[model samples]
Target chain A: MNVLLDNLSLFREGFIGTLELTGASALVAMVLGVIIAGFRVSPVPPLRIFGALWVTLLRNTPLTLLFLVAFFVVPKVLFPDLDSFLLAVCACGFYTSAFVAEAVRSGINTVPLGQAEAARSIGMTFTQTMSLVVLPQATRTVVPPLSSIFIALTKNTAIAGAFNNVDLFNVSKTLSNDGYDIAVIFLWITLAYLIVTYAINGLFRLLEHRLEVAR
Target chain B: MAEVSVTKDAAPAADELVALKNVNKHFGALHVLQDIDLTIAAGEVVVVIGPSGSGKSTLCRAINRLETVESGTITIDGKPLPQEGKELARLRADVGMVFQSFNLFAHKTVLENVMLGQVKVRKVEKAAAAQKARALLDRVGVGTQADKYPAQLSGGQQQRVAIARALAMDPKVMLFDEPTSALDPEMINEVLEVMQQLARDGMTMIVVTHEMGFARSAANRVVFMADGRIVEQATPDEFFNNPRSDRAKDFLSKILHH
Candidate 1:
C-alpha cells in the first residue's frame, strides 16, 4: 500500500502514456488498414501486389523488431528530433495495421457480390459502390474482428518498454528495482491492463449492438 | 407509340433501341453465351426463356455490360455500350437492371433504395427523387414499408421494391434477370403483376424468366435459348402454339407442365 502511495505520480504518468500509445496507435492503424484493404481489393494489379506484400511483410515481423528498427532508423531519416513516444506509436501502429487490413478485407468479402453489382448497374462508380453500399455493410461485420485487433494492440504496447518509454510495464519494473513488493506491483498493473482491455471490449460491444443489421 | 421492328442481323435497323451482334462470352472453359444476335425496339417487351445454364441471365446482363462479352457489339439507342470509364456509367444510367436476388441495398430503407439512382445517377433533386420514389413504392404496393430496410420485407415485397428502384431511374430500357426466380410460388404472382403492369404501360423490357404465364400474357415475343444459342424467337402465340424448333418444343413440354 505504501509502495503504491509512494509512486502514485509514476503510476499516473505510466497509465497516461499507455493510453496515449494505445489510442493514437489504434487510430493510425485503422486509417492505414482501410487504405491497405482498399488497395488489396482494387482493380489495379500493382496496388494489389503492394497490399499483399505489405501485409505479408509486416504481419510476419515481431513487434520488438519493428520498434528497434523504427527507433534506430526512423528518427535519423524521418524525424531527427522525434520523441521516443511518437516513434513507439508509429511502430505499434504499423505492425497492427497489417492485422487490421486483413480483418477489414474479410469483412468486405462478407458482402454479397449482388450488392456491388446492383450498385454498379444503377451507375454507381467503384468508389460510390464501396462507400455507399459495400463499406457500410462491411463496417458492421468488421466490429468484432477489429475489436480483437485493438485488444491485441493494447497488450502489445508493452513492447515500448524496451525503448524505455515509461508505460505500465516500465513503471512496474521501476518499482521492482527500487525494492518494492514486486508481486503486488505486478498484480496492480495486471489489474490495470484488465480494466483497460475490458473497457475497450465494452465500447466495441456497444458499437456492435448499435450497428447490428436486422435480418 | 411507334410500330417496332426486330432485327435478325449484325446491323440493326434505325428503329432498334437495344441491339446485340454476335455477342460471345466465356467463363473459363464454359462458353456462357455464343453468337447472340438480337434487337428490340423502343417499348417492346421480349421474354427470353431457356433451360438452366442456357445463358438467359448472361444475355440480359450483357445489355448493361454487367457481364462483358468476349467478342461482339452491343448498342443502345445507336450508341455502342462503352467499355469503361464515365461513359459506361452514363450508359448504365440509361439501362436499369433487376436481379433474381432482389439485390436491394440491405442497409438502406425501401424508399432510399428507390431514390438513390435517381439522385445519384440522374442528378434529380433529393426532394423530387423522394417524391418520385414514394409514388413508385405506392405503385408497387409497398409504400407502407418505405421506411423499412429490405430484410424487414417479404421476398415478394423486396422484389417489388427492386422494381421500384429500377423504375425510379426512368431508364430507356429495363432488364429483368430471372427477377421472380427467387420468390416463393405465392410471392411470385405479386412481382409478376407489377411487371405485367409495366408491360401494359409500354415500358421497354427484356425479361429472362421461366414463368410461362408471364410469357403468354405479357411478352410481345418469346425467345427460346438452348446451350448458349437462341433456338427460336417468335410472337407468344407462335412460339407457344407452334414452336418451330424441337428444342423449344422439348423446353416447353418440361416447363409448361412443371
Candidate 2:
C-alpha cells in the first residue's frame, strides 16, 4: 500500500517501541518472578503470606484496571511526571510477573522431594542444594511454561496501545485515523506480534535444550 | 513403649559415634518410633530388620536428624543433633546416607554426583574431588558409568554409584536405608556385594534392610524390630537361628519361607 511506504518511519518506531517495551517488561517480570517464587517457598510465614497475596491480587485484577491504575492514577498519586510508556511497561510487567511466579513455583514442585533430601543428606547447605541440584532440574521443566508466559506477554503489549504507548498496536490506530484500510493495518500488527511471539518460543526451546538433563 | 534396655547385652563401648536416647516420633495418629534408644560404636555394622512400617527406616533416618524427633536426644560424637541451619548441614555431610531409591542427583553425571558434595560441602579442589570420586566409583565397580547420567545406568549400577557418592564424603557413619529394596533380584546381590565390602572394610554403618542373608553374613549385630519397638538385638546366629520373641520368630519364618 502507498500509505504503508509513506509512513515507513512511523512503522519502524512502532516496531522498535514494541521491542523496547517487551524487553524492559520481560526483564522486570523475570527478576521479580524469581524473587516472588522464592518468597512463595520461603520458610518464613510473613514472606509466604506476602507472596500469596502478590500472586492472588495481581492475577485476579483485570489488566485494564491495572492500566488505569498505572496510567491514570499512578501519575496523579505516585509519580507526577512519569512517562506513559514506562507506566505501560509497569502495568504489563507487573501483571505478567504473577503468572511467572506461579509457573516457577510449579516448576520447583516438579522436582522430586527425594532430590532435596539427598542433597541434605550429603550436607549441602540449602543454597548449594538449590543452586546445584533443585534449580537446575526446576529450570528444565520451567522453560516450556515460562516460554508460554513470555509469548503471552509479547501479545499483551498490544494492550499498552490504549494507554498512549506508540507500540505496534498504536501504529495501527494512527494509520486508521489517517484513513488507511483497517484490515491491512491489523494484518501488519498481527505479523509483528507473531514475529515477537515466535522469537520468544524459539529462544525458550533453545534454553530448554541447554537445560535438559537425563531423568 | 515401656522403658527398658533394647540392645543392652550387645552394646559396644568406647568411641560412641552415634547415640539416641528415648527418641520418640509420631506420624499423625501412628506412633512410628516410641522411646527408642540406639547407639552405634565405631566400625560396628548394625543391620536393622523388620516388617514394613516397623520404623526401621525412620530409626535410621533419625540418626542424621532427617526425621525430627518429637522428644528426646540424638547425639553424634557426643554433640546433640543441631536443631537446624548450617550446623545440621555440616553434621549431615559427616553422615553419609544411601536410600532405597538411590537418590543419585538425577541431573548430574555419575562422576559429578560423586564429586559435587566434596567440592561444594567439603570444599575439596575439583581435581582432587574428581580423583577421589573416580577411585570410589571404581571401588564400587561402576567406574565405567562415570560420565553417564543416573537414568542411563541400570538400577544396580545406580545403587553402586550411590554407594560411591556416600563413601566419597568419607563419612564418620554411613546409613543404608533399604538401599537394595528397589533393585531387581539379580541386581540386588551386586549392591549387596558392595555393602559387604564396606562391612569388611569396617565402615561404621547402620543398615535398615529386608535382606536376611546380608544380616546373617555381614551384620555385627542384627536388630529385630516390630510394632514400633526393638523386640530383639542379637548376633545373627543367635537371632536368626533362635529368635526369642514370638513376633520375631513369626517374622523370620514368614520371610525365610517366602
Candidate 3:
C-alpha cells in the first residue's frame, strides 16, 4: 500500500493509458464491426464472402499473435514509421471487431423475417427496410451481446502492455520490479479493470433501457 | 383480352389492376403454384379460399411478388413486377398487403407504423403523413392506440393497426392473407367488418381467408384452389351453394359444417 502511494503517478498514467487505449480501439472496433456486419448480411455474394473471411481470420487468431503481427509486420509491410502504440491499437480494435460483427449479425437474425417482409410489402427498399425497420428492432437484442464483447475488449487491451504500450499490465510489471508486492499490484490492476468493465455494462444497460419501446 | 405476353407492357383494359399469367413455382419437390392464371379488375373483390397447403395464400403473396414464381409474369397496373430496386418499391406502394400475424413494426408506435411507409416511400411530408396516419388509425378504430407500441395492443388491435399501416399508402389493391386467422374468435369479426366496409367502398381486394360468411357477403368472385390449382372459380352464390369440383365439395363439407 505504501509502495502504491509512492508510485501514484505511475498508476495514474497506467490508468489513463488503459482508458485511452480502450476508447480508441472501441471506436475502431465499432466502425469496422458495423461495416463487416453489413457485409455479412449484404445481398451480394462477394461482400458476404469477404465479411466471412475477415471474421474467420481475425476471430480465430490469438490476441498475442495479432499484437506481434501489428507491431512487427504492419510497420514493415504496410506503413513505414507508424507508431507502435497505433499498431497495438489496430490489433486490439480489429480483433474485437470480429466478435462485434458476430454479435451484430446474430442480432439482425433475431428480428423476425416478417418484419423485413412487412417493410417491403409497404414499399420500403432493402436499405430502407434495414435501417428503418430491421436494425432498430435488431438493436434491442444486440445490446446485451455487444456489451459482453466490449467488456471483453476492455480486458483484452491488457495484451498491449507486452508490446511496449505502457498500459495497465505494463505498469504492474514496472512496480513489481521496484519491490512492490506483486499481489497488491495485481489487486489494483484487477480493480481498475473492474471499474472499466462495470462502466461498459452500465452504458449498455442504459442504451438497452432507452431502446425498449413502450410495453 | 388476348393472351398478353408479360413483356408487352400493353395496358390491359383500364380496369385491370392485377394479372398473373402462366405462373409456376415449386418449393423443393412440391409445386406450390402451378400454371396459375388470375386477374382482378379495378374495384373487384376476389376471395381466395382453400384448405391448408392448397396454395391460396401463395397466390395472394405472388401478386406483390412477395413469393416470386419460377416462370411466369405478374403485372400490376399493366406493368411486369420489377425484379428489384426502386421500381419494385414504387409498384408495391400501390399494392397493400396484410399478413396473418399482423406483422406490425413492434418497436414503433401504432401511429409510427402507419406513418412509416407514407413518409419513406410515398415521400409525403412528415406533417401530412402524421395527419393521414391519424385518420387511417381512426378509420380502423384504433385511433386511441396511436401512441401505443404494437406489443401493448391486443391481437385484434394490432391487426387493425396493420390494416391502417397498409391503407396509409392509398394502395390501388389490398391483399389480405388470413387477416383473421390469427385473431381470437371474439375478435375476428372486428377485422372482417373493416374488410367488408372496404369492399363496400369499392376498393380492389384479394382476400385469402377461411371465413365463409365474409366470402358469401363480400366476395364478387370466389376462387377455390387445391393441390396448387384453381379448382373452382365462380360467383359467391354459385361457388358456395353449387361447388363444381369434387375438391371444392370436399373442402366445403369439411370446413363449412361448423
Candidate 4:
C-alpha cells in the first residue's frame, strides 16, 4: 500500500498519457477507416483493389511489427529525428484503421440496395444519396462494432510502452521494478485499464439503446 | 365550377406528356426490354402487369433511367433524354418513382423525407417546401404521420408517405414499380385507395403491379408483358374481358382464380 501511494503521481501521468494517445489514435483511425471503406466500395475497380490490398496488408501484419517499422526503421531510413510519439500515434492509428475499415465496410454492405435505388428514383445525386441516406444507415449499423474497435484501440495504447513511451503500462512496470510491490503496482494498472474500457463500453451501450429508440 | 374549368383546360394535351420510341434494354446476356414502345398522355394512367421476371418492373424503371437502356430513345415532355449530364438530373427531377417496398429514408421523418428532394433538387425555400410537403402528406392521408419515422408506420402508411414524398416533387409523371406488392393483403386497400384518388385527380402515372382490381378501376390502359416483351395491351375492360393473346388469357385466369 505504501508502494502504491508513493507511485500515485507516476500512475496519474501514465493514465493521462494513455487517454491522450487513445483519443487521438481513435479519431485518426475513424476518419481514415471511413475513407478507406468508401474506397473499398467505390465503383472504380483500381481504387477498390487498392483499398482491399491495404486492408489485407495491414490486418495480416502484427501490430508490434508495424510499430517497430514505423518508429525505428522507417524514421531512421527516411525522416531522422522525427518525434517518436508522432510515429507511435501514426503507427497505432493506421494499424487499427484496417479493422475499422472492415467494420464500416460490413455495415455499409448491410444497408439494403433498395435504399440506394430509392434515393436515385427520387432524383438525388449519387453523393447526396450516400451522404443523406446510405451513410447514416451504415453508420448506425456499424456503431456496436466500432465501439468494440475503440475499446481494443484503448487497450492497444499499452503497446506504446514497448517503445519506452512511458504510458500506463510502462509507468507501472517502472514502479514495480523500482522497489514497489509488484502485485499492487500491476493491480493499479489493471484497474485503470478496466475503468477506461468499462466506461467506453457503457457509453456504447447507451448509444445503441438511443439508436434503437430513435429507429 | 372553377375546378371543372381547370380540368377541362388541362384535359386535351394529356396524350403528349411522355413518349418512348423503340427503347430496348439488356442486362449482360439477358435482354430485359426488346423494342419496347410506349406513350403516356398527361393524366392517363397505364398499368403494366406481368409475371415475375417478365420485365414489367424494368419497363417502368427504364422511364426514369433507373435502368439504362441499351438501344432506342426515350423522350419526356418532348425533350430527348441525354444519357449523362445535368440534363439527366433535370429529366429525373421531372419524373418521380415509387417502389413496392416503400423505400423511405429510415433516418428521416416523413416530412423531412418529402421535403428533401424539394430543398436539395428544386432549391425550394425551407418554409415553402415544408408547406408543400405538408399538403402532399395531407393529400395522401398521412398528415398525422409527418413527424414519424418510416419504421414507426405500418406498410400501408409507409407507402402513403412514399407517395407523398414523390408528389411533393410535383413531377409531370409518376412511375410506380409494384408499389403495393410488398404490403399485406389488408394493407393493400389503403395504398390502392390513395392511388385511386390520384388517378381521379388526373395525375399522369405508369404503374407496374399485379393488382388487377386497381387496373380495372383506376387505369386507362392495361399492358401485359411476358418473357421481357409486352404481349398485349388494351383498355382494362377489353384486356380483362377479352384478352387476345393466349399468354394474357392464361395469366388472367391464374391470377383471377387465386
Best by lDDT: 1
- For model 3, the DockQ equals 0.75
Chain B TM-score (model 2 vs. true structure) = 0.96
- lDDT (10s digit) by residue, model 4, range B102-168: 8898889999999999998889999999999999999889899899889999999999999988888
Off by over 4 Å in 2: A71-86, A179-181, A205-215, B1-14
Ranking by DockQ: 3, 2, 1, 4
Q: Is the docking of candidate 2 incorrect, acceptable, medium or high quality?
A: medium
Q: Residue B186 in candidate 4 has what lDDT?
A: 99
Model 3 per-residue lDDT tens digits across residues B107-204: 88899999999999999999999999999888989999999889899999999999999999999999999999999999999999999999999899
lDDT of 3: 0.88
Q: Candidate 2 local accuracy as lDDT?
A: 0.88
lDDT of 1 by residue, B28-129 (tens): 999988888888988788999999999999999999998889999999999999865578888898888999999999889999999988887788999999
Task: Report the C-alpha lDDT of model 2 over B88-168, residue by residue, as the tens digit.
Answer: 999999999999999989889999999999999999999999999999999999899999999899999999999999888
- Give per-residue CA lDDT, model 4, range A16-96, as digits (tens): 888888888888898889888888986557879989998999889989999989887987899887776777788889988
Lowest-scoring 10 consecutive residues by lDDT in candidate 3 chain B? B1-10
Residue A78 of candidate 4: its Cα lDDT? 92
Regions of model 1 farther than 4 Å from truth: A78-81, A177-179, A213-215, B1-12, B83-86
Whole-model alpha-carbon lDDT for candidate 1: 0.89
User: What TM-score number comes out for model 2?
Assistant: 0.91
* Steric clash pairs (candidate 2): none
Best of the two (1, 2) by lDDT: 1
Tell me the TM-score of each prediction against the true structure: 0.91, 0.91, 0.91, 0.85
Cα distance off (Å), candidate 4, residue A69 = 3.2
DockQ per model, Cα:
0.62, 0.70, 0.75, 0.43
Alpha-carbon error at A198 in model 2, in Å? 2.5
